[model samples]
Target: MRIRLLGGLEVTSPDDRQVRFTTRKTSLLFAALVLAGRRGHRRDQLSELFWPGRADGQARNSLRQALVDIRRSFPPGEHATTYIDGDQDSVALIVDPDQTDISIFDLKLQSDRPSDLAIAADLYRGEMLAGEALADGMDEWFGPHQNKYEQKAQQLVERLSLALSQPGSPEETACEGLAERLLASDPTAEAAHRALMRIHTLRGHENAALRQFELCKALLKRHLGAEPEAQTTALAASLQAGKAGDLPLTAPKANAATGPKPPAPSVSTPLHDRPSVAVLPFQNLSGDPEQEYFADGIVEDITIALAQFRHLYVIARNSSFTYKGKAVDIKQVGRELGVRYVVEGSVRRTGDRLRIAGQLIDASTGAHLWADRFDGTLADVFDLQDQVAASIVGAITPKVEEAEIERAKRKPTESLDAYDYYLRGLAAFDRTITNRSSLEEALRLFMQAIERDPEFAVAYARAARCYATRKSNGWMIDRAQETGEATRLARRAVELGWDDAIALSYGGYVLGYVSGDLDASAACIERALVLNPHLAAAVGVSSWIKICSGEPEAAIEHASLAMRLSPFDPRLFAWQFNVGLAHFCAGRYDEAAAWAGKSMRHQPNYPSAMRVAAAGLAKAGRIAEAREMVARLCAFDPTLRISNLAEILPPFRRPDDRDRYIEALRIGGLPD
Candidate 1:
């Protein structure tokens, strides 16, 4: 007998004669038994599975009748024992897995050989049992199986797309067919769309490739209400620019002398130094199937929270949720997802009480680094979820950082990619206390990162920030040239990083300070805060923008909130300076001077901190000390006189605020 279950249930005799089951239940039961292998399923379990909510004796009778019906479907006089075997306790199908198409497909998928994978691709004709009439509640049991096969098929096509990247290869056409089948199964499969785009581009069908990109974009927006990911967008852009061949789907074969080595498996060698993580769907232990939505919501919240961190590489929720309802090995998941960490959790509810438990695992080693449980009432479920997400992110961030630090130690500088260069630039930027040398190095490094990947938005923003620092310290030799360059970089950052909070934060600050565009700057900063309310840098920048706009109270409140979010933030000096400036604007001279003193202790030579200290001290009648601050500020930057103060400082929105600041500096004996 030959059994096929890919498109639908079909059985044939050795003479190619069609065989039909008397009832749909008998066919489903036969498929179930065949999938159960030689060990078979317990009669009680099968009864509960197929005839749920029925009495034990009645369900057993139904199962027996179904077995009889299945046996009768076979050739008569061939004996029921030939295909079906049972001895009261349980039942078995005497068919080898290799004899069935679905099982054969799975076995072929297990092999790493491309030829075997191609055959596996051919066997998955469509969704498993695509048009079979499942029982009313049978979908719950069947959905996972169908989804699992579909996910495997998607992976198979992507692997084949990368493997058969060459033009005019025989398998390339087969891979295209598999890609289309994947789209038929799931119209929202971006990977399938990307594969088709690349295949078309390789076959010199540029227009076809561009059309596929538009289709992917429309489908994503319609179904997900989101834009395509950065990778997909970059691929589409390359295709549009007629540089499709420059962005190969697979790495070129490496030669000993000149060619680059093949990508590694650590967090997908393409991401280079980035450490990726995935949060699997939290299991619903509440016994009520309805709570599945609650469990999924928790995972989604956690995934979004984790993605807010600029340095973390988080896998999308759609990809992570594919592991739902499966018993997965952590190592295998890590390898398949290209993530170093995996987060899994469970939600259990009893009465009005809720318990959410989560664990962070080092996927490479299967070691649990952190685990915690939160208890709350359903009335406060939203707050409970927020607490869970914050706890998980706060716990795992440091662990990920430690791992990345160690990885950086072992990585060669020659192999540094865009992300690595960006990280190095960030480190240099953080160490730039009052020296132009460190700031210069940070700018160069950031520019290098941008050169390596021109679409890197945050790198552009940070590089613009370096120019902002130079302007603040009076280090620019040619103000017009530097201002124009900073504006260009800042605008590019804003254009490219519409959805990135960190990029928006820094880019907004530079544009406001250097280009005097307060309205546009405020818009970008406000959007960044909306995107990630917990981002301390965005909060800090918003506070500075408020101060520039002469809203001292709002500025002070935002600065305080930023400090609370990151009390020991690397940019603590900047936060303190913002608070001081806000207090100065509010005419609280004593408090302003005190806060400015605190900022100076962190960065003594920062010209703005010195100016704020002098202005506050003079307004509070500390004559000698105020004059000393003025002298120190001038020693740092001789050109910073009251005459040119309007040109040097950030453009103030209120004339009264600017005049008051200048009057205070004049009282401190600044040069005319």
Candidate 2:
């Protein structure tokens, strides 16, 4: 018998018959244990996570009934212990390596080979436990695992795409096949789309390459209200203009968007260097004509923020808004505005909450650049407006910057060995994922970078950033000494690279987060934004300050915007924490608890998230659940105390807020 949890719950009998449980709670119980992987959960833990509303005795009784249902779905025998095993204390699913697809997928991902990655991609049928609606409580336990599997799938897509881009790889067809399957699930996946284009060009199928470009371009524009990045455009040009005798095999592969694509020899470049964008007024979907003002307000805010980007030419509001209430073609809008991108959306206000959905499109090809939805209480409608603006600007700038960075990296590496060290540091830094060992390794690489190039301000900023990370995570080895050192490095970064956005932003972060100088930090970040308004990290830091400084609403707006700006950013979980903190500070305990759940869902091992969630749940009147969260938090970090929270927390501008925070944590059962 085989257990399946990849798409949905199912058991394959030896006779090839499919067996599935009808009880939703039973399925959740089965999933909880299997997704736990090796760490078996105590029966009590499972009971509470799935049935928190029930009393302890009732919850345990419910768990017993679910377990009965789960066992009945499996093949008959004492083989019951072979599939599911548990004592009175704990329970878990034992994976049969040969029969389980996830085990094979996981094992294959451990290898760096492209073939292995492609094999793993084939096993991920869809979202984990797909087609099943997860209740609120189950999500806190199961969501992170689901995201991890999805991330693994994405990594596979990236590797296979890279393989297809290689000139003489024997697995081009196989890699393309796997990539297409992945794209079938997420059509807007830029890497997979690019891979298909590369595959066609490699085979000398010019028409296929052109068609793939149009398909990608059309989808991106139609869904996102934006266009393909310049790199994609230039690559399409390369495919089309290739001589009948020769093709460019080295179309830039999937990479962290940092730089630009080299234009094809026969193609003419755009007159301007920046991406041009027009912000169209959002449609009033609230069914109330009075909400038209709110919709228009969101568009205006987005326009202003986008106009701040030096690398993006934004159409004036007067021009963009002329098409209001008119069903103008996106392509026509693009031509009229002389812009490459157009932003559009709809707003619906239901009761006390407004839900806003927005998309960025390529005006010429109708390719979607980005799309997302924002939901929040109407009390903070202005904050919601800012979030929409931040999201759109965030979506467009990174890809352009990434292409530029890649181009810079592609230069001969011998003369630029210092930069090589810096690149290695960045790779290591990304691996940190808020872990101690990886962070230390990244710092070592950054140190080597500056040793080779004494003038590398970005390296200094990154080095200083290590201390700030430690500060954020409460991992400071020696608080005062680390803060002083971080300040020294930050000051050096500001002096050495006034124009470098990375240097300024990271430097500003250290100053604000560690050195406790908000004003100075603000100046550095402000200057960095002037240099590159699209620096998502800098915007997030700004939000952090607002959150701790008694401006919860502002912090949430900025944090949410920062998240939308770079959705795949590794540090996004940390930013989500800020959003939760902001809601908690604003006395929106329910919202705070919900966002806290989101942070933990993104990073299940994140300890701070437990604390925030506990505090919120306690304040929200879910005492039993809050106590449970506190127990988990203390198990993760035994030394945490309610009284000492101020040591880890930034000095709040409001004393009352500080008192409330501490009291809530205490009520949630934190020490002292």
Candidate 3:
């Protein structure tokens, strides 16, 4: 029989048919035995897990019965000893060490080398026993182990991300797919998000990068009742602002916004120009910390919805959230956030009614440009959010003709309720990264949103991206099914919302990562950019693809363009890393070293940066520095050997280029 654990739990007989257990608990028992490795649980422990809260006699009887059923099913003499029961010790899965998928997953994860990542990703089936029941005793017993697997999945994703980020490799397509899977399994996983964002951005899908921020914001709001973690938010902001190069790796001081604000409105500033704006965390005027999420959600939704407008250069949710619960002068806030206009608000909820008061401030003069109060029933909450965003958009950009405002007000697809669910789904998806349960919750919310609005192209695109990412990252078991679903949904997104930059970028990114059609990927990303030049996702993805396709010079240029557009973006590491990779591919060892050094400066222990730096040092004949860098790489991933390095690298379009990179690493002393 073959056991699969990536998608749903499935045991197949030799004939290739699924083997169904009488109860899910039995499957759980088997899974536990397999995951436990050689050391199995004793009878008493098994009883507690299988029949918790029961009397000792009853629990023992239950364990005995379970064993009897398992034995009968196995028919010891006829069946292979997949399960072995000991007299007084424990029960274990009996198999050759190399036969089991779980063993393979463990071996890959335990390896300190980056090459094992691909194998690990392929072995993932799905969320462990995805549709299995976790009632009564099984919940406690399996919960911790599930958590452990989820964490391992995340680690493997990081390893693959590092590998794919290297220069001169064809593995990027596969790695990109794996990263997508990882994100699907844990949408809010910072590493997964960062990896996907980097890949998409390089492929010239800057809008996709921005969508990543949206997803992150949605997940955070749903789960934490808060914004994304500071680092993640900053990363997204940096990408959106096209300032990925300028963003610092460490979290900026929470007490103060990071950089200077955009120039104030003046004679030089066009009247029709919507001075970009950022909505900082509103003061909780109601004196209830519990209401903070509502207040923050209001800001986030407005920010996201407004950002969709082609004319508006709204700051990403991350940079805006830096001011959460902090006090600051409006001019200082504007200056630090790099926006000429600022929107500040307060939320007061009373029973079934909510009172939201907001103002648009001219950062240059600290004058109130527009102020309004929205008083309504709880059901009208989302409408109030729309009104607030629309008002702010109109106030800051006086030339924004009424028609333009109306155009901006156009609902995603005439389904306000679906939009609401989409917002809520985004919230859940953003917070799903810390654990498996959260990921499932996020998926549930996304599915709920999709059901409410089947034609919601952005929603479909995001869902597809999520599932594809989950499979790619080894966070799920059934890679083929998840990716297949992603492909279908992404194609649907294009059919439904061809004009939506986000949909195009996200859908195109999924296509490129999973299917390796460079032409299609390029076309989709280019279309997204033409529709929204300021869309950071489009810019980032385009740059990534250029580098992977052996046009490192173009990659650097694209990254530069993205940085200029979104200067305060928080995800600078991605841009810088791409720049470094491009330089490495172009054989600019010195420049590559500098860029890699810059990346390390931002994210000190970033594995990709470390490898890039090592490669640069090796190419430059700085043997000592190269060796030191390799040592660091090895310490981070001990299983990294020269043979595996070549295997993990993305295929180089040029044989000479590939040979050069491999030789550099070999000289730098990668083992074997």
| C-alpha lDDT score of every prediction, in listed order | 0.79, 0.72, 0.65
Using alpha carbons, what is the TM-score of model 3?
0.37
Off by over 4 Å in 3: 1-448, 463-486, 600-607, 623-652, 655-659, 662-672
List ranges where model 1 is wrong by over 4 Å: 1-273, 280-298, 308-312, 318-333, 342-381, 387-409, 601-604
lDDT of 3: 0.65
Consecutive 10-residue window with the lowest summed lDDT within model 1: 251-260
Cα lDDT of model 3 by residue, 155-225, tens digit: 56655654554433444555566667766776657657766665666666778877877886777556434
* Candidate ranking (TM-score, best to worst): 1, 2, 3
Indicate the worst ten consecutive residues by lDDT in candidate 3: 399-408
Candidate 3 Cα RMSD after full superposition onto the native fold (Å): 25.5
- Each prediction's RMSD to truth: 25.8, 11.8, 25.5
TM-score of 2: 0.52
Question: lDDT of candidate 1?
Answer: 0.79
TM-score of each: 0.52, 0.52, 0.37
**Residue 467 C-alpha lDDT in model 2:** 77
- Summed backbone clashes in each candidate are 0, 28, 86
